[model samples]
Target chain A: MSGGGTASPRHVITGIGAVAPTGLTCADYWSAVLRGESGIRTLTRFDPSGYSATVAGEIPEYTASRYVPGRLLPQTDRMTRLALIAAEEALADAGADPSAMPPFACGAVTAASAGGFEFGQKELEALWSKGGKYVSAYQSFAWFYPVNTGQISIRHGLRGPGAAVVAEQAGGLDAIAKARRHIRSGTPLMVTGGVDGSLSPWSWLCLIRSGRMSASPDPEAAFLPFDRRAQGAVVGEGGALLVMEDAERARERGASHRYGEVAGYAATFDPRPGSGRPPGLRRAITMALADAGMAPADVDVVFADAYGVPALDAAEAEALAGVFGPRGVPVTAPKTMTGRLLAGSAPLDVATALLSIRDGVLPPTVHVASPAHEHLLDLVRDAPREQRVSSALVVSRGQGGFNSALVVRAAA
Target chain B: MAPFPTFTTKQLVDLLRECAGEDEAVDLDGDILDLAFTDLGYDSLALFNTVSRIERDYAVELPEDVVGEAGTPRQLLDLVNAGIAERV
Candidate 1:
């Protein structure tokens, strides 16, 4: 096949930043993942005694004020604050100076499944208890989904295209994909990813209604993805963002670190069960591989969504079987330890994939001692797998049928 | 009658530095009588917080109208003085 049109400028991840349940920084999170450590524990953010789920993957110790400026604290939600910290770290990691680039040559794109739920809940409480007059003016924008993109751009003086994706669990990949598009279209750089904190009473109540969360009180077994005894997922808090830059521009800027290249991306939707169509995950994976001009065999590792629901788990395995056949690829779901972060999950998976490619090691799928079902796939478990991982495929499926897949290749 | 509590531009500068952070370039000795809050790195939200802190310390509530009208430190100081006088 002849390559048409100067193939869109290749995009590379120049920097990565994460605020996950296991750790506050990308290095800490990746270290915990390699050690097969689980961040799940008893839910102390609130008294879960009244709720069905008592365990969660909460960040060990986080103070938003530590990262956000005091002047901006009143205007920021926890989610936005987390995003800001991650963005700052990613820019530093990439050694990107937006001011050095043309002001309009850099942009920001963020994914947010739940926009400032904790902040909105607090505002609602004040309104109900103390009347409208007591409500904060910051409530108007802090609870907005696009507040992260706006804040990150304004803080760094990025005047290029900015957007926020709200595709639930799939939104994180979508944000990264959009950032890649932006970089291809003349933007030199983009700060993109998803971060969320929806552990408040109201957010938890809404999640409970979805019927996908594990109510197990035991932290070790609460969120067992791909295990025969799997119940459901645990709602996790925190997220990650990445600094994506044009490969050539990064090189020109003397950036010494490059995580990986965003080779290709594709998104699909699962029709309702009765629609008689194959699972959308298979299509997403196939499309992503094709977009990357790669074959299934080119992928070194597969990061499964691992929703932790039995039916969903089986369906994902079946999708993998259809794509790479039974035991076709080495698969892992480190999220079993971090719990399900909703939209924030996929970006962390991408970050993990980049680290895996860089270090040539695949992190294990913690807590899955027994195979959930018969499948033709090598599921990494118990201990980390050290191997040559030049390219990785990360997949995500949102609750409302959104499916997305991304291909990350080791920087050449 | 009790004496009215007074506020100086230096005190206002100090409050801004304390609330916004000492690293922010809030002119301490410059002629800030006509400088807007934004000039001092104070957005509307930060300005509101500064006003709240002053209210808490002075035991007086600056009117919402006064807050909206006071754009500079001098204007804010005048409003605070007026509020303290009314409260006393």
Candidate 2:
């Protein structure tokens, strides 16, 4: 559906740069996801034999020196390094050089939850094992949640409207929404989306403690979102970054490749538990559809926020059913392959959704062969489905009652 | 006691290499004492880490301001050696 053509300048995705356990770049990631390759495995960063949620999706064949400068490596963390690579790829893909444009015409935004846990773990290890003096002074900001934005800005000379959001998984979508705001409010281009990770034992402890993580050792049985034997999430590292620019700006720069338009976005916080009010997931879905000036039928596919937990999964299913009828839309969770990337999850899903729009095929939800119980949803499983995906909805939720929904429709 | 020795350009360069990667253009073998850390491709964070290493290696306590104030290797040598001299 063409988003009201003349009302407001649309924010369109011009480029994608993503890294996950499955693939290192947007093209590779899309290929792996469509081919239904599983990247989930036992955690290898550090021995997790003693931990419950031992499985994770780690980026394959990634070498830091190859992607980031050696000087920046000492000052930055793994998350920041990954983000820098993604940002550089995105800039090149868009062909919109920041140094060539007015400083205020470009911006950067990113999201974080664990905030460089791998790096923090290293520093803390040095602190305890050795002494305080051994701690790198880079610890001051290397572990900071917003360091990705700051580092990206500095690296690319992006001097406009920098911001960072922290809402666990939902933050990815929120960060993209913020970038879209900057694009609408006169900024021509924004480096946005999230490349997040928390794969360290230190952050792993926190993730496992949340009781939302799977304790299963088997990769196939672990982190299943909707299946009967579904366990909790298998935490993963790395997400994705996207280059979103105003349609007119893209046209001017001759970077006319369009993934889709960020047509609508809405976020809601779930009321305090036991407050008697309903969960906000349903409301967020409804409002996002309304914001896009579309009805429930307008959406062709849904990228689910599939929390593998039984209760949360049920809630999300009910929300989808309330918006679309039972089995109304094709819903998939390609993340089942790479596990959930916390703050990185939604942006990865957003990138996958755009890819789905690009190639008329919907990626499958691996391992979840059948629903746990009779649910009013059509789960795409095992193999990718060939479909004409014009508009898609991406749903994401954070632990602290955060619910966010974004609508991206095929460019007119 | 003998006069407290100031850190040499070689020592600072060593610390700089440990803090960040070694830069090829910094002319480490020649005179680099007065060269600004920025010119040597050392950022504030690198300098801070270098200071931590220096404090440990020399058993000195540099002031908090040294990381920002010491732009050149010579400046860092003076501030850190001055702190060490006070103790000696």
Candidate 3:
């Protein structure tokens, strides 16, 4: 339970930065979450003439020059640009010397669902329209791959073992889990989370083919994850980076810490169609509780992954009913207001959960008229709710059938 | 979306500024690189955002390379007009 020891599972978050539909930084994002402000806006990133979903939680006022150098900005796809900004903020908040830390001891693990599709599409269109020669050399590494981790490592001099997790939406929590494992295994520090930007015509065309995008033109009605009128999810883009380090090391360094423990993590896959959750999601929650060395009764809140799609929402509700067993744990899906961040979504939810623990308040799920299911969990709605949150569970499931759950505890 | 036509430099400047969501202070002939996309005072996200706006307002699907090629207002105008001509 201490640093400098060879055997300890303690991982403390030293700093955090998030570029969400809510806001650009942790504080601003958290504040917007409380106010129930929706970042969903009309499609300005790409024309939606032929698309089914024309709304998203687009990050407004994002300029690479504002965060990254103009010269390097052109080389980086929008995804990496967002990641770098979040990483820069997290590193500064941690006060870790990117230069001073042992390059091998400081590591990074981040996740992405769609990768750099916007940039990839630009290059792909050029190739399609003007032949292969028109494709930018940058496209070789920028699009649809897990290069955000590599890009962050290169830009920040983090030479430690870097990794990219591709678990779809749950990839965000999965990346944090991986970072915690590295820290436990003696990596001094790790920058971890999810970042992505895929709201482009190329990406949209693929999403439309999948038949999961919301078709409603009304912004409020477009992404109703747990509502009677719910159609499907709204695609969003952004990134969140948390500077995680050994708790003892953080204290020894007199570093300012945000939250206490990652506590628990579990992942599952529900591959079979119409099987609901394939029993894996419930098992994942149970495993996460066990990993936290706590019982389901110990959790103070549940951040549910209300997928908006009727069938998936039912599966999640069933999973919750089986695990929590009528405990009526207060649950919320603030992402309803901002649209889902895909790979970046769940980590932002985790961040919101952590901030809720810190602030002793719960954010509301905007626009859900009534609980979508009769599971009757205490769902926060319309406005922020005051609560004593000691520990919470955040859950998410990806499009290609990946499910993940994590337990986070407040600093004791 | 309206079809674009050959425009004078003043009209080109206005079109570029409108697409960029900025005012007329933008240099119509200056190096676009030196003018940080922000310095041009375009709304953040407008670098790519203006492409969508230009396409809609001018009814032209500009080439993706336009971001790299449209350094001056004249270039943007030329690109739009050329696309319009092709469509016509």
* Highest-scoring model, TM-score: 2
Q: Which pairs clash in the backbone of model 2?
A: none
**Better by TM-score, candidate 3 or 1:** 1
Worst 10 residues of 2 chain A by lDDT: A1-10
Task: Provide the DockQ value for model 2.
Answer: 0.53
lDDT of 3 by residue, B1-88 (tens): 7644654556544544543334345554555533545456543344454555566556678897787677645566677778878877
Instruction: Give one digit per residue, the lDDT tens place, for model 3 in A1-412.
Output: 2222335746788888888877888888888888999988888876887777888888886665667754345457776888888999899988987678775878899988877888887877877886654455456677746688887887788888799899878898999999988988888889998877677788888877878888887888788766778898887887588899878778778887657578888887775877653657888888888777888889888898888888877777777878887536777898887788888888788878888888899899988885667555667888999988889999988877788998888865
RMSD in Å for candidate 1, one decimal? 3.0
Residue pairs in clash, model 1: A326-A376, A327-A376, A327-A377
Docking outcome class, model 3: incorrect
DockQ scores for all the models shown? Answer: 0.27, 0.53, 0.04
Give TM per candidate. 0.92, 0.93, 0.80
lDDT of 2 by residue, A35-144 (tens): 89999998787899888878899876577787887678788887788889888888887787889999687898899987888888999999999999898888888999
Which segments of model 3 are wrong by more than 4 Å?
A1-6, A274-277, B1-88
Cα lDDT for residue A294, candidate 1: 86
Of 2 and 3, which scores higher on TM-score? 2
lDDT of 1 at A252: 85
Clashing pairs in 3: A225-A308
lDDT of 1 by residue, A81-178 (tens): 87888899999899998987886989999998989888899989988996765566678788998999998998888899999999988999999999
